[model samples]
Structure formats: structure tokens, C-alpha cells
Target chain A: MAEVDEASKPLLRDLKAVGKKFGHVMYPKKSTTLLRDWDLWGPLLLCVTLALMLQGGSADSKEDGGPQFAEVFVIIWFGSVIITLNSKLLGGTISFFQSLCVLGYCILPLTVAMIVCRLVLLGGTGTASFIVRFIVVVASFGWSTFASTAFLADSQPPNRKALVVYPVFLFYFVISWMIVTFSPSHSDGTTDTGP
Target chain B: MSTTERNKNPNSTESWGGFEDNPIQGGGSAVIDMENMDDTSGSSFEDMGDMHQRIKEEEEVSEEAAATEEGDDGEFLGMKGVKGQLGRQVADEVWQAGKRQASKAFNLYGNIDILRPYFDVEPIQVRNRLLESLIPVRIINFPQKIAGELYGPLMLVFTLVAILLHGMKTSGTVIREGTLMGTAIGTCFGYWLGISSFIYFLAYLCNAQITMLQILSLLGYGLFGHCVVLFVTYTVHFHSLFYILWLVVGGLSTLRMVAALISRTVGHTPRLILCATLSALHMLFLLYLHFAYHKIVEGILDTLEGPNVPPFQRIARDIPEVSVALVNTTVKTISATLQSY
Candidate 1:
């Protein structure tokens, strides 16, 4: 074997090599990067902590005859802000506060659309109900997806952004509808009306 | 004579590189002499056959000894055992048993595709094989620190959004008799299929290392149970709400799996923010809808059914034409029905 230069060989090269070997197993390039950072973890931790706290608070509120809605909303707002700040700081294309603001923008429009769909389009057996539902779900979810992508992107990967947004929005649309249709009537169960 | 030539010609027992230094057989008489000197060695052709048999038996005994020694150290079976006819027979029996058990467990849901890979190996080998396979995956592919750190929060946020949205959709209405049943079934299948496909898709992208047989096996497991649920739901015309719910939940689960699989560069803060905010907004809007509609519907029902019904009934009866009277009666009846609930 020929003698090799010691200095020319980078110390970090071995780590990089190990990472490359691992890259084969992990699949998807994005996941590889996520494994390397500390800042990225902060928002995630915050989001989870807030979610649990909110859930517990809501449950307790219902038990204590306090309002559940406001508490839940506050938790959501808190989580969104933390996530937004984290994304911005972590080098997301989008700004820290913009993502959170987008949520506010989407809230009213989506609510109106859902209400309109239910009031004007639903009731009595017909294809109208189905069409309305499909429209509502697609429109709301589609817009929500766009908003999320825009909120997070400095410049998205063309259509890749939609992958995250569309499916999630549609999922929310359906789940929301299902919960409404199936959960016990507010009066019968804990329908916290307290302010 | 030079040391090399002297060793090569005479004793025949002195091989090049001491026989152990060079793993490959270097041509030398030392090996031949050792074989020739052994008591089992013979001159006749029949004796040669017996010598070969003895050699084979000795190798087998050594292998068994190795296995025993290694087994204590947690090396279950060697590659030779796995590749042997006995291993294949055991694998076949385990596979059959897995299929039967899976089928029974998912009685209504037939043809679940996601879980097939898990059941393909013999029951005995399943855990060992799975563990073996996971070792490389864990070391090479699974970004455990990252995935574990991110996944918990991601799941928690996702669950919250799901719950909130569900709350909004069905808040004030009469609990539809079968909607829950339908939603539960739908969610189960939807998540199962979504996760299964995502895994398959990831496997496809990752070097094509996973065999087609493996992918199909997993798909088979995933789809089998889910399909049964689909069949039951469609056949019985169970609640559409449930079906819709299932599709969404399944899609979400699948989406997450894909994201994780493709995570070559998960941009930390930005991704987290986007995920969290979007989820929160989705939940908030849904909850709003749930409360508003629920209250309105309940109010409408109450107005018709409580206190004001007798007056409406009298008015309905007094209407001149039967059509008008019927319409009035129906309106009052529906209003009452909703309000009373």
C-alpha cells in the first residue's frame, strides 16, 4: 500500500461516510437532515407540551363546568406560534410569524364555507348533499393546504408543498364533519358554555 | 537448498504461509501429507469413499459444536441453518399458521395487504429474522433520535386537530345511530392502508433493496383486514360519515409515513411550524362549525317541539287546502322533532 497524506484526510470525512451509509437505510433525503439539529427539536417539544396541556385543561374544564372551547383555542394558538417561530429560526423559507397569521386568515373563511355548505347544500336525500360535501371538503382543504405551503415556503419545491397541505386539509375536513355528526349533543354531554 | 524449496519438496507438511496465514489453499504437499498420514486415509477406492464420509461427518459435528457455543452468546442459528431444507419447512408451516390466525382476527376484513410481509416468514424465524433485518435498518436508515423526537409531537398535534375537527362537525345533532361504527371502521382501514402504502412507497424509493416479494407481503397484510371492513360497510350501506372519516384518517397516516420515509432533509423549525399551525387552524374551524350548527339545530328543534307545538298544530289544521295543511303539519312536526332532542 502507498503512503497516504494524514492532513489531507478530513476528520469529519468518516462521519460523513457513516451518514452516507445510513442514508441508504433512512430513505428520503429530508429525514437525514432532521436527524442533525437541536433547534428543530424545540418547536416539536413545545407543540407536544402545549397539545397535552390543552387536552388536559379542556378535560378538566368540562369536569369543572368551565368553557372548553376557549382553553383549547388558546392551546392551539400557543402551539402555532411556537411552531412558527421555530420554523423561521430553523431556516424555513417562510417567516416566523407569517405561518401563524395564515391560520387566522384561514379560520373565518373556512368556517363560513363549512356553515354555508351545511345550511344550503345539505338535508333531504339527494346527490346535492354529496356534491356539497365533496365541494366543501375539497375547497376548504385545498385552500388550507395552499395557505400552509405558502406560510412555510420561501420558495416551495413546485408541487411538493401541496403534498403536505392537500391531504392534511382534506383529512381535517372529513374528521371535523364526522365528529360533529357523531359526538353526543352538547346538552346531553359536557357542552361547556361558560365564558 | 533455499528455505522455500526445502520446505516445498520433502516433509510436505510445511505449507506456504503456515497454512493459516493464507486462507486460500496455496499449492503445497504439507496438506496432502497431513491427509495421507491420517488413520482414516485408505488406498482402495471404497476406503476413499469412507474417508470422505468421515470428513463430512466431522465437519457436521464441528458445525453443531459451533452452533451450541454461539447459541449461548445469543447467535440463534448460522446462515447454513437458515438456508437448509429444515429451515424452509419450518418457514412454510409458520407462514400458513400466520395466514390462518390473521384471517381469523380480521374475519370481516379480507385481503389486508400491509401485514403480509410480517407473516411470510416461518413463525419460528419471524422474530429472529425481523430483529436481524431491523439491525441494519436501525443503524443505517432509522434516524431514531430525530424520528422519536419529532414523531411524538407530530402525533400529538395530529390527534388534537383530529379531535377538534370531529368536535365541530357533530356537536349539536342527534347522534346518528351508526355513524360512530362507520367512522371507526373507516378510520381503521384508512390508517392501515395509508401506512402500508407509505411503507411500500418508501421501500421502493430506497435503493430498491427490499424485494418485491417483501413489499407484496406487507401490502397483503395491510389490505386484508381493511378490505373486510370495506366489504361490510359497503354491503350494509353503513354511515357515509364513517367512510369519509376513514378515508381522511387513513390518508393522514399514509402521508406521515411518506414524509418520514422521504426524510432526507427534514428542515427542522420550518417543517414543525407548518405542521403545527396548519393542524391548529384545521381544528379551530371545525370546532366552530360544530358548536354553531349544533346550537342552531337544537334551537330549531326546541322551538318546534316545546311550548309552541300546540299552537302550530292548530294553525296547521285550520289551513284551507290539504296540501298547505300537510306542509304546515310537516314543518311543525320536523321543527318539533329537532327541538325536542
Candidate 2:
């Protein structure tokens, strides 16, 4: 009984520490402790939820069809891998897991944007819908790109920054394109959708 | 005889009648004699050797007298000497204690070290890191420092300046209209104070160890993005792209600060809720500003010159659809040519 009690004390302390780590994500300042002692749980959870959200938002669209859950996952996973590899090839020193963590967390703004898009779609379609969708996509893309680069940019050799940033730009452009083209089909079938 | 001469010569006590023989009278006369002896000190140096011998004998006699006095009233004599020393020591202690208390109070205002990053961080880096929401360690450490008291006031000053600049840019008549300027300032301060206090109260209820000043500073820091936006708008005139860029950058900056605060105090779920709530409030505040501007202008002009649409709504009109169309066409051309195969 005494041994069990002693074991549980450290366990409780660890649990508390984990909780604190999760909270630190919201902090504006980068916590070196968090960077040093990274975990996969939070990033994994966020990626899943974000993918689900993006899928759910596009699910109702008949034109160009919504992305499947697996497709969303593949896009994020593959994109992260490509970006991570590209950075490493360019003499960047960030570990694979750390790169993945940064990339995954960067999806948060896009996730929020998608959720907002979903709500906006519920209101109507046409110029207003396109406008809101366009703004949200652009904003989220900018945010994700900026966020990812902020973490990854410093790792690359100074002379090769543009080379490293090019892939990031393309990555965000593709995401933005997907978001912009995500048009929910109207039952009325008015094909003349104003740009 | 002077008290010093009397103290030097052991026989002087016998001539003057010993303090033991008449303690009250002897004590009174001893004080009087000491006062008179102050003027005769130069003349007394002539018999220094003789006086030294007498002083040694007097010390022996006084030591014996003190020993006897200890038996009769030792506690009283000891206490008298102690009281004199204790008064000086107590006063010294009290002065030191007050200084410590004042320093503790002054610390609530904030520390200069927290502002170091703002100066040390390169401008380009600030723009990049701020937009990405990747806050540096120093920026994070700023709020955690005990010296965060200055954050609120600094934020206020920056925000007020931004608002004034925004007013100048938006309205030609604003510079001349005292009432308008006053109203704008009042509204800005009122909103900031109200929102900061509300958040502070909510944080308090959540059992977070955040101070009112910290919350105020956080909110104030969030406005910095807007300050930049206003500056750009004032200088360059309105450009949709620049506006959106600044908006995102500002939003991220604010979000980062709020996240930092929430992470320290609340649980994960509560932190998310609080963050979302704060973000929504910020969006709402922006919306309110848009409408409020129109109302103020309409009231002043008595007729709306143009529809005061939210700047975000202009995004649709401003979007470069031509580029999007070209991209779409290129994709279609490639896909269709491949399908022909």
C-alpha cells in the first residue's frame, strides 16, 4: 500500500505538468521547456479535430465534393513530411517530430476559419458567401504560412531562406485554393455563381 | 565640584556626601556639576597625570558601587541603559521596515526589463514572428515578470495615439471638432477599461492568479496590431490587402498574449472557451467601431455621403478575381488536355 502511494505521487505530479503544457500553447511567448519536452498528444488531437472540421464543412458541397477524412489527413501528413524534408535538405536542423508538431499546430487558425466558413455558408450563397470564404481562406492561409515559417524559417541557412519559403508558400496556396473552390451545391441549380 | 572632577576623585564623593547617603540630592547635583564641567575641560588637562590616577581609582570605586547597586536595584539600572539603546535600534528598524514596504508597493507598477524585447527585437523580426503567432521567449517572459505593472499604461498610451491617428485619417473635420475628439477618446478609454475589468473579474472567478494590471496590459498589447493598421492606413490610404495583413497580424499578436495568460491560469477546456470568448469579443468590438464611426459621422453631417460598410465587406469588391480565373483556366486546360489522352 505504501509503495503504491509513493508511485502515485509522481504520477499525479506528471499529470499536472502535462496539463500545464497543454495550457502553454495559448501563451504568446514560446516556452523552451515546452519545446525541449515536446509531446505528440496535443498535436495529434488538434490535427484530428481540424481535419474533421474541414471535412465536415465541405461535406455538404456537391460541386467539387468535400474532402474525405482520410484525404484531409493525407494532405496534412504528406504536406508536413514534404516541408520537413525540404527544410532538412536545405540544412535546417529541426527534428522531424518538432517540425511535425509545429506544422500540425499551425492548422489551428485554418480550423477556426473553416468553422467560421461553415457558419457563413448556413446564411446564404453568392457574392456574400464567396467574399466571406475568400477572406477567411486568405486570412487563415496567411496565418498558417506566417506561423509555420516563423518556426521553420530560423532553422534554414540564411542564403537559402527563399528556397525554404517557396514550398511553404505553395503549401498555403494549395490550402487556400481548396478552401476557395469549396462551393456547396445549391438545390435551385443556378449555375451562374457570381465571382 | 564638577561631575567629571567628582567622578575622577574617589574622595570627592565623600566631600559631596555620597550618592548612597542621599541618592536624590546627589543625582541632581551630579547633573548640575557635569553641565558646569564642560567649560573647564581645557584647564583640567594641566593635571592630566594626576587626574588619570584619580580616574583609575574612581573607576574601581564605581565598579564596586555598581556591584553593590546590582544587589539593591540592578534591574532598574540595566533597564535604563537598555531603554536608550532600544529606542535607537527600534527607530532604525522601523525606518528600514518602511523602506521595504514602499519598495513592495512600487513593484506593482511594473519593471523595465519586461520592455527590453520591444527595443531589442528587430522590426522585421517583430513583423514576421508577430504575424505567425510565434512569440519569442523574451516577449513571453515579459508578462510573467513581477515588473509587468507598466504594461497597462503603455498599452493605453499606444492605443490612444492609434485612435487619434485613425480619427485624423478618417475625418477631415475631426481635427477642428473638439467634441468629436473628446467623444472618441472617451469611447476608446471606456471600452478598454470596461473590457479589461470584465476579463479581470472573469479571471478572478476562475481562481487564476492574474492581476488587473496584467489583464489590462494584455488587452492593451492586443491593440498594438490595430495601431500598426491605423498607421499604415493613415500614411498609405486604404488598401484592402494591407488592411487584411495587418488585421491578421494584430489578431495573432493579441491571441498569443491571451493564450499566454490563459495557459498559466486555467485548465485546457476553460482556456479554449475563454480564448474563443475573448476573440469573439474583439471581433464584436471591431464591428461596433465600424457602426459607431458611421453613426458619429451621420450625426455630424446630417446625411450619409456613402454607405459606411465594414472594411471586411469591401474584400469581395477588392478581390483579384482575374488571377483566380486565370489559375482556374490553367488547371482546366491541363486536366482537359490530359483527359484527351
lDDT of each: 0.36, 0.53
**lDDT by residue (tens digit), candidate 2, A16-96:** 755665444333244454456656665666668756765664466322234456655765676677667656654577776
- The segments of candidate 2 whose C-alpha lies over 4 angstroms from its true place after superposition are A1-34, A57-64, A186-195, B1-341
Interface RMSD of 1: 14.2
Model 2, residue A130: displacement in angstroms? 2.0
Query: For the second chain of model 2, what is the TM-score against the true structure's chain B?
Result: 0.41
Q: Give the per-residue Cα lDDT of candidate 2 at A73.
A: 70
- Off-target runs (Cα >4 Å) in candidate 1 are A1-68, A71-79, A82-90, A121-131, A155-195, B1-341
Evaluate residue B303 in candidate 2 and report its C-alpha lDDT on the 0 to 100 scale: 18
- DockQ per model, Cα: 0.02, 0.01
Best by TM-score: 2
TM-score to native of every candidate shown = 0.26, 0.32
Q: State each model's TM-score restricted to chain B.
A: 0.21, 0.41
Give the per-residue lDDT of model 1 (tens digit) for A101-129: 44333333344444544454336323354
